[model samples]
Target chain A: MTNVLVLFGAVIFPFVVGYILISRVPQLLHTPLMSGANAISGITIIGAMLIAGREGGNFGYLLGMIAVVFATINVVGGFLVTDRMLQMFKKKGNKNPQE
Target chain B: MEISLSAIGFAHLLAAGLFVLGLRFLSSPTTARRGNMLAAIAMLIAIVATFLDRQIVDFTSILLAIAIGTIIGAFSARLVKMTSMPQMVAIFNGFGGGASALVALAEFQRLSVQAQLPLPVTVTTLLSVLIGAVTFSGSMVAFGKLQGLMHGAPITSRLQKWLNIFLLLVVLVLMFLIIGSAPSHALFVILTVVALIFGVALVIPVGGADMPVVISLLNSFSGLAACATGFVVGNNILMFAGALVGAAGLILTQIMCKAMNRSLARIFIPRQAIQAEKALHDASGGVSESSAAKSDNKPQIDPLAAAVQTLSAAKSVIFVPGYGMALAQAQFKVVELANLLEKKGATVNFAVHPIAGRMPGHMHVLLAEAEVDYDKLREMDSINPEFKNTDAVIVVGACDVINPSATEVENTPISGMPILAARDAKSIIVCNYDDKPGYSGVENPIYQDAKTICLWGDAKDTISQLITSFSG
Candidate 1:
């Protein structure tokens, strides 16, 4: 019963809330917004970590280790790249002309 | 290791709240960086909490994997150019999906070997692996097209639609079979392989012009796959984050589809069919071929001298940029030209189409990277009316967005699509490599307009030449 409820909440609730949240965003920030969301999807890192830390033998450990590597890349890379892109949107007075 | 499950759950709830706040802030530009920081912090909290969970039995390997991943991630994110952001995002999406699929596969294998597989766990595991595999392979194809490693044009045949449908059915049947029986590792493996192929098939028929939509859709798939992984692992924070990403990505995809004046259903139809139909219409003389043929004889001008003269005389000019500007790395030159024009007492502004570059807000990001003033960049609706009163419009490496056929011609590929009214300006100067048709395979008649001057060369070369001439 709990599983069904959790699955329902996971699938449907976020869709409703996320639609409302994203609708307010202007078109100019859409790319950064997508990148930011891409970063958030890296939440799979949690599951990957759990698997890696488990004593699931050699093959399982190998898969978990790779998963960890990939998820971390998504989290670290996604956030930093998004920040780099957003940094470019500074106001005229605050602009860094060097880049 | 001291934190209890409930405590971890509470932390996840708080993290989820921060993510929502982060997205809210990201809706606007000024606070977007702070929003990104907030989300990053939230991710940090989630990771740290997971590491502290009692279920963890090994740390050395996990930490080592994280170290390796961090080095690659930070380096690529820091080093990649702003113009190639879409390809970078695609690659990242692929990695995320691949990770989710691998986690699910590992968990399923462990459970099946232990004879402890439950129905719900089994279902979610199958789903995560399938969606994740597809997202992984599909995003690779998207990255290939964007990076020019593969042709940007859609590769499809008449049998593509049927083949995709058949493959989808096979995967579905295999999924049910796995779910119905004891965990058959071989069946799961086959399902993953089929799903991966299906992902490649799904993206191959999509043309480069529609890459933004493809990227957005793939982004959503990666999120949903993560959500399924969360279910398999029984992690609340992972589930919430996945849902958030899935929802946001879908909305973005819809917005991109709307901006292109294309229905989501129409976008999935192979581009070859659309092109073939248009070809048949053209052959039957449905639209006048005279203008297309006459384009070969259109007068070409000395772009540098003509652009300098035009800038010198014009009191107000609007610059329209497209994917070609990004392709040629000409955004900095465009910014320089705009600065020079502003100094000459001619007001300069950028007219940005919503779908102008490879992705949503692509031109805005490119110009922003070039340090173009935010106020000087205007959206399609706001700038369309101003074009008629504008003295000169300089088109930089753009085609379809400024194509007059979008507004003038009927029953064509780009008809009724919103475009900049560059044709209404006093004079139009186009800087591109050649007078070839744009991505839609439709010949642009604007190049043949008497007042229009074609400057055939790379955008960077031509724009810099104009800047030099203006300085002289």
Candidate 2:
């Protein structure tokens, strides 16, 4: 159907663009880039939120709650860890700490 | 007030655009933090939009779960040591994968109550369950290997290949049965169980050294699982972001495979099988001559004293750090030594190999944490050509990256893997734990070379000694 075709197009578009952009990330930032990408994959939290907040049985809501918790941890932990790493990279300066 | 589906769709489209820009900003370190912030903001937008969906009737439980997750996630991120970063990433990946699986299961439960499930929804639900379960369990195995909770060596069995194949066949058959008839809870549960086992089987035979490739592959699997869930839930943003991450993980896996000079399949197929064939070849060849030479070449000079003399007289030096350096916790001492050498009128640079630490860019982060100037950290290709012109090369707890046998030997696990040109340096000082084969288990011939000085011991003690001797 047209709906399937449109969804496929959406998926392909982001994937191609992401591949082109991510391939250029230098070796120096590979770890941060990976952690950052992992965080982005936590977009599953959106699906979790819908399931959790839906008008469903107690068990369904509980399942959704657990999913939300897990996805949020991945999203939050991944980004913050990546930031902590990015903060460490400093260019050479005259006031060399080691010197 | 009810929100329109088109309004939510518009918000998702905007978030997707921001996600692309966020990744684009990661091309350089200067813009990377802003990129991360951008992506974080995108996530916020998506979450807020989801909360406004008309189907969402309850708010208290979801908000409470977010708070719990936030506290735990923030504390772990803020408290984890940089050295344990690979494990941290692996565990977080597991959480993401598990969430996707849970979402699919919840949706299945909600849909199963209906009279009939659409074929497309049923298919997507099955795919999500399979991929998500595998990602979750595979990542846990990776985390355990990296964190030393389990043996870091490849755990293989004679029947592993057969078992994995059988499991795949069973899963396929189950899919057919479920699609052929009305889906049942038991069939889905069985499929999830099989997929989880398959994940463990897929990663267990991989050695710790191959964890970077495995972790990246699992990241890709987690993304694909999310994409499948998106199809099940009919969510556009989930599909878009998931595909983006999936592509990113695959690209990283490809890069790692190239850097390590390994075929994609080699990471999973146990190296023991390859080594067995190599052993047969070596037994019939002139292998004993090399062993004899190695034994006769054992330490002839006081390498530590020689190392100190070379440090004092050298005008140019290159420092190579490997996983061993990280293991020895010698980054700070290494910086101290580099400073001493510099003060003594010697130029110093740190050569980082692409596969240097447990994961990609691991060594760079550790060196940066030790306050080493980013400019001084040269990547393998960029620094390799300079090794020959350098006067002294100080290898701190590194072995495989600079091993000559990788290029010199044939039919070995690391044969043809590009190595640092440390052998080309005029004088080499190695402060390592031992002259044993590294993670690849291939004997390094460079240690026995006449121009190389091996100061074998704990890297921290050895480096501290160098600092003291050079400063004095």
Candidate 3:
């Protein structure tokens, strides 16, 4: 029972902090913010690593391997795309390499 | 072993702290790029710490899978056009959800191979599977709609709401069975299948124009699914990061819903009230006819020529862009025109509607990609009152955002939705595909205003013509 309460507390703590922090994000960077947050959600890869890297390489290994791939794609793709967009947003006369 | 566990816990704590700090910096433009880097570093720390776990023995397969994913992910991210970023995000969200679901499934499989699982594990695993599958399939449908692979209009069946209810009931029953008795593998598989179908059902009825809200909600679901998986696997880092993502997505969703003046429920299950409202407004058509008649009293002059004349005389200009600008790929030309106007000694600004384009901040991103100075872009609320003082407004492939009917009419599809006050400007130049109603299916009356010039054609061609005529 105590473990469950701690788990719930863990979830709630970040949720409230994220809410307060993200609400302050301006409308200008919403797309990048969303994609960046999406990338961080790929933290599930840690759990996937545990499953796939376990001693017994069986059915669970296959599922875990696939999970790792999916999570990696989300993390790598999400962050890069977000960066690509953030790089585009510039003030007047500021240097943008893509230009 | 005890010492190593404690060290790993400490590393995870540090990573979580960095993640929070990273998200905090992401809120501002000046530090956003650095924020992304921080988050990436935090991810690295978490992964390395996880590597120190004693249970991890097979690094070869894990490394290979990550390599494959990294190559595919990096290539897609690099090659995707700026305009297609929404679709790219949707697909990435799908993969994240799919991964979380798979993790939960693997853990459940490993546990079920032994005796009956604990009640907590059983519940969390089921929750993860259900929510993750829904996010995964729902995001794919969103991707298809955004990518033009599927129709953008709302696709519904006669029993759409009822079917969703039935699916929910079935899922509940399945979950109850798993919880009530022993955790059966076959039952779990059935539950996963049902959840996946429910996901498709949930998102398909939402129109493409409402995709911003749907995408944000699905993004939230993906995070919550990860959180559930964290609970199932007893991982603190996953839970913390997932919850943060959940919160971020919800905040975005709330903002989008408010910007569009739409209720979350109405976005998912649209009513026939809008059609009835449209019928009522169409019956009372005096407002539109009067405006049209008033416009007819002006001396006969070509709209494009009049627009050019207005542009030449105006000392202040505002540009309003929408999804049509994206479809026509006219951001560069629009920017070119804005620059030309500025060079002609006109004060220029961009009036960006909150719900403009396909996603939140979509128009700003497109304009930024075209090298428009971010300082020139103004949010709707701040720019609404300035429209009255503006000498001329250039609306590029936009309609609903500038539609006067949204405010004038009651209970229509877009009634009460905040709009860019383009009608308040002295001279309006609309470069739209046609004078047709926008995605809202409500006719825009501002096109018939006496001071408005409707240049009906592709925005790219029309904007180029404006630039050429102005330059010559």
Candidate 4:
């Protein structure tokens, strides 16, 4: 019963909240926003970590290792790319002194 | 190394809160970077907590994988140009989905081999594999279309719709077989392969012009896949984060579709139906106004000389760029031109259409990379009224957005779509490679307006030539 309740909460609650939040975003920032959201979707990194950390033998280790690599790429690549894109939106007059 | 389950759960709850806060920050440009960082940090916490689990048996392989993934991710993120950002996002989305599918498969194999698979785990595992396979393959197709590795036109046949439905049903049946009785690994493998094929089929019919919507939709699919994987693994934080991404992506997809005055269903309509619809609309005189205007003889000006003369005399000018500017790799030159025009005493501004380039905000990012001031970039609503009083409008390689048919014609594909009011300017100068119609396949009557001067050549070359003439 708890699992079912969590499942419903996870699916429905976030969707409503996320829709309201995302609707407020300006069209100008849509691409960066999508990329940012993509970065967070790399939440699968948690599952991959579990698989890799589990004592389920060699095949599990192989699959877990591959999953970790791919999820890490999604996490690192998605966030960094979004940051790079957002940096371009800085006003021309106010140059950031720090790289 | 043995952390209490409640402690891990508490950490996950904290991480989920951070994810929500990150998404909230992403709603605005000023706070977007920090939002991304917050999410990244949350992911780091989740991964670290997972690593500390007592079940971990090996460290070397895990470290090796992390190293390889970081190097590849960081390098690609650093090196990929802003113009190819969409394709890179597609690739990353594909990787996420593929990872989820692999994780699910590994868990299923482990459970089934030990004959300890629970019903909920089996159902979620099958779902994870199905959605993951589709997202992985569908994103690859989207990436291919965006990168020119595959044709951008819709590939379709009369049987395409039925075939996709049939394929989906077959995969479902195979999934049921795997879950119903003594779980057959062979049935699961075949289902995964079939689901992958169905994914490819699903994306192939979507035309190139609709790729932004497809990319957004695929991003949502990847999130859903992750959510299913979370269920299989019983990870609440993963489930929550996946739900967040799924919802956010779907909302973005809807926004993109709305911007284009299209629906998700319309995008899936077979290519033949779309072509026929266009033909039917055209035959009913929906395009007659533009076609009639096209028959008029508008003078073809030497764009370089005309641009030089008009720009020199203009008090205010609006430069509207489209996908053509991106394709020409001429954003830097465009910025340079805007600067020169400013130097010549013209008040120069850029009119950005919401859906001007291949993706939302595509043009803004391109211009921003060229160091164009954010304040100078005007959205469609803000700039439309300025066109009438503007001295000149310089359209560099943009077509459909500036096409008067969008407003003047009826029953056409882009009839009711909002466009830049470049036609209201005193003089309009267009620099395009040719007189080719834009993505909508509608003849742009804006080219034939008496006040308009069409310059046929490469946008970069023409713009450069104009710069030289102006300077000389």
Evaluate every candidate with DockQ and list the scores: 0.78, 0.81, 0.81, 0.69
DockQ order of candidates, top first: 3, 2, 1, 4
What lDDT score belongs to each candidate, Candidate 1 first?
0.86, 0.87, 0.89, 0.82
Per-residue lDDT over B1-472 for candidate 1, one digit per residue giving the tens place of the 0 to 100 score: 2457777877887898899899888998889999999999999989988877988989988999999999999999999999999899999999999999999998887888855467888889999999999999999999999999998888878888888989989997997798789878899889989999999998888887888898888888889999999999889888888988998999999888877778775666654557645753663345435535655665555556776787799999999999999999999999999998888899999998878878778888899998898778888888889999999999998888887666666656666778888999999988987877777766777777777877788999999888888887
Q: Which portions of model 2 show Cα errors greater than 4 Å?
A: A1-5, A94-98, B1-4, B273-300
Error of 2 at B316 (Å): 1.7
Q: How far in Å is the alpha carbon of B426 misplaced in model 1?
A: 1.9
TM-score of chain A of each: 0.82, 0.85, 0.86, 0.84
Of the two candidates 1 and 2, the one with more favorable DockQ, higher being better, is 2
lDDT of 4 by residue, A1-99 (tens): 986789777777777777888987876788888888888888887788778877756787678889989988998999999999988886756765432
TM-score of 4: 0.92
Query: Of 2 and 3, which scores higher on lDDT?
Result: 3
Worst 10 residues of 2 chain B by lDDT: B283-292
Residue ranges of candidate 1 with Cα displaced over 4 Å:
A1-11, A96-99, B1-3, B114-117, B273-303
Backbone clash total, candidate 1: 0
Best-performing candidate as measured by lDDT = 3
Pitting candidate 1 against candidate 3, the one with the higher TM-score is 3
Runs off by more than 4 Å, candidate 4: A95-99, B1-3, B114-117, B175-179, B273-296
B167-278 per-residue lDDT for model 3 (tens digits):
9999999999999878688998998899999999998898877888998899888889988988988889999999999999999999999999999988887766457456
Residue B62, model 1, lDDT: 91
